[model samples]
Target: MAQAARLDIMSIAALVAFALTLGARTTFCEGISCGPGWEAFSSSCYKKMVDPNGWLGARFHCVLEGGDLVSFNSSAEEDFVKGKMGARSFWIGLSNLECNHKLCPQVSGKELKWSDNTLLNHSNWATVKVASTNLESCAYVLPNAHKDYHPGKWRKVSCESSLAYMCKRSPDGCQEGQPCNKTAGLALTPVQTSACDPGDFLRGHFCYRFENTKKTWQGAEDDCVLWGGHLASVHSREDGDWLIAHMEDNFHVGLKKNIKMFEWRDKTAMDPALWYPGYPSSDDCGRVSRTGQVYNHQCNSLIVFTCQKGVDVTHRHHQAHLVCAHLRSFSHPCSPAHSTSAAPRLE
Candidate 1:
């Protein structure tokens, strides 16, 4: 009997714990409690009193309880309060004390700006005119059926008339300047680098290279010029280092084949001094093989070729048909020499 009783007690305790856990996830709306004519918005409560008080007096009332007159931005927000509080007229936080004489003069004094700072402009006014006499020279916000202002409009009204007024209390349920930190049990981590890098110029992170033997050095240079780039030249040691590191073992630089005679495309009468050591003499012109191996070939042999700039680290197999420099000052205009009439082979 004692064992059965112990099991029953354990079951009861488990049920109570489960109920508490479920209750923790539920949100309750207690509605506004500020007198009979007030409405609630989320956690804060608002009331529209029928006793017409001047704007200054209304503001003072709100301030006394650590609150302020309501300032609304969107139709949804207005409708939300109206739906909750039911149709009633109320005084809002707007007044026409500044620039009152001008046609459609804006009420200038905004004690605080909303996050979007839209209320600072005060342009969304209702079109109806407030009679000069009723012109408490102020504006009141209305709600529900009595909330009959033109949609997307505002109206100026009098402060002395006994109309319901709105009151908004801070949702924190605490006084200002008190610490209201909620994440007492949690921690946050910092990011080490920005999500993106700055100064990245390459498109699709790629560079191109081109090859030609049908033209003389001058003609070849012209071909490059027409294509918006010059003969690919290394601008800095960093560039050279990148090329050396990324290039395949048998890659060619700038040599051309002429019936077994080899020469640099730049046409400088030097002893092929620029050729990286054991290169150029292996063949006269450059050609990238099917396996991406670069070697010197006879110039007369019309092997379709081009020089490429940088290699894309992400995709090593992809090759560029033409290489171009990213110039700093002068912009170069070059178009592809080959026509799109013929489909390109992947190899």
Candidate 2:
């Protein structure tokens, strides 16, 4: 019997030692804290900002800081943020631009995509609706015990509404152009445009040149493709106006038919077909000419053409310029134009 008790005591001692080792490796402290502008989130930290600016302006601010607006990824994340925010209202990075500004319930199944084309595939939303003004086409979250709506509820409001907000950064790596400055308190600086010259016919998200160089529809398409872009397809009247503003002469876009009279080359047909009123007639297949303030064109006739591709600043300076011109110009600064303190923010 004495031997049995001794064996049991030995087993208890081994268990105690194992637990102590584990506790050392995974220590949890009560009331742990992070630096200013940062709130504790599980094992990481987040920054919350309250911008009184409208939705568009708020979005600009977040991008200026090299981050998209807030997109919650989980219920626990939302609840944790709410607890940190206390009773204040804050903006989240979501909008119903595609849905005509209506409030959407907690998005399920496929994740939502932001206007800049970023995916909000993670969790970070409430299941209830909060008070919002009709002018409020944007959404925000409130943190409090008021579970008046279920947890993770989102309130749609006007973009013009002023509210507090939260910002998140991956504790693992800082975004490019944003440095972790211990002295500056984690605030992001604006990204700088490089000194490289703009490529062949591209400037600021629009592709163009000052002189009209003659080429066939096929030739123009080939030139654009050589530059790693295809012929342009104007999406809106605004696009037409933009093209007109830069051109010293008329140009052609892809929209031609083969000798067989079948429509080819104009790749934009794959997208929702958009044309000026009374456009795309049998005779107008490849025609584009500028008349005073308007543009007219035929697909088969040769005129200078514009092509476009997306831009990435991280690319080599020359390559970036070539790519930007081939795709489209980076016309808008990464930051919006209205704020002097704000810098350009790209996706």
Candidate 3:
């Protein structure tokens, strides 16, 4: 009878423990809080920046603060946004276009996708079909821009159009410094060396430098050109990842709003893979954070920027020397050319 009583007590204890575990998870939202000036709702936090920027610039500011443009998942969330936005139009996290390349690629389908890859289960478009033209694929919500700004109505616009943007973040993820760390054990393969001037770092086929002086977007671009390169054109996720790994603070990227879609300064199609997702819209220029996310912003804003230049002939000769060094090490198959000259080491 004593054993039976103890067993019954153990079962009750276990049941109570399970209840406590469930309760803690339910209260996690309570424990997590947004940063100052950010509003909290459910499990996420939001802040509306009144500064005018292209869609990309707005998204960059949010990412710099550890979030992205707000993405809506339900009618309630949409309604909540409507209430928060009040009578002003603002950029959201929806865009049908991707522009990391020199040119914006045509999407296969007309359906709009969220930059954050949120599920497209619910929508509150003002029109039955979203107008996704080749040049205008970035989206925004017009809750009360005017009497005609239908509540909950969505509009697709050219990414270059500047407007105030809204940012959203989950309170659980808000604690802060650099969120992405240099990946251990995954050594990047050295592709080429450069005779880049002091302060420049070589990565793959190009050399990059973060200028100390701040300038307006156009002025920055001009400076890059004068230094024998253009503003950096990030082509892939690898590029973005590598960039953020080495860069600090928010800086201008190379994307600019064209007639309809965003384009790289060099006129190449953008690699969608480089974006943080749901980005590069309704802005004439781009900005990046230490997190490696790309965002739209205004062209006239004064900010620090990055630059890129191709390896010159001196670097090419260094690459040849490296190739010769590899051949010399394999003495069994060493050729006369390898034996005649000592391999020059490139720093």
Q: Quick one: best lDDT, which candidate?
A: 3
Cα RMSDs, all models: 31.6, 21.0, 21.2
Mind giving the per-residue lDDT tens digits that candidate 3 earns over 1-347? Answer: 11211221222222222222333333222234675778887767888777555454455445445566788888787778678777555677776544211112233234567655677788777668765433334577755322332444776653323456677777775323212101111111212222344335445445676675788889999999999998998776556654554443577878887787778887896666666667766667888755566788888888888898764534334433553344334331222111222112111
Runs of candidate 2 with Cα error greater than 4 angstroms are 1-36, 97-136, 142-152, 177-347
TM-score top scorer = 3
Evaluate all candidate structures by whole-model CA lDDT and list the values in order.
0.35, 0.42, 0.55
Provide backbone clash counts, one per model: 27, 47, 22
Instruction: Candidate 1: count the clashes.
Output: 27
Off by over 4 Å in 1: 1-44, 97-124, 128-136, 142-153, 174-347
TM value for model 2: 0.33
Looking at model 2, residue 236 earns an lDDT score of 47
TM-score of each: 0.29, 0.33, 0.39
User: Cα miss at 169, model 3 (Å)?
Assistant: 1.4
Residues 273-304 of candidate 1 have per-residue lDDT tens digits of: 34444555554555333232234555445333
Cα lDDT tens digits, model 2, 1-347, are 11211221222222222222333343223232454566556655677664344344344344433344556666677777777666665667776533211112222223234433335655444443323222214566643212333333564433333466665554443333332333323222222122112322223333332225778766777777776666666654445544443443466665554543434354433122344446545554443334212233554565555665433322323322332232223231121112112112110
Better of 1 and 2 by TM-score: 2
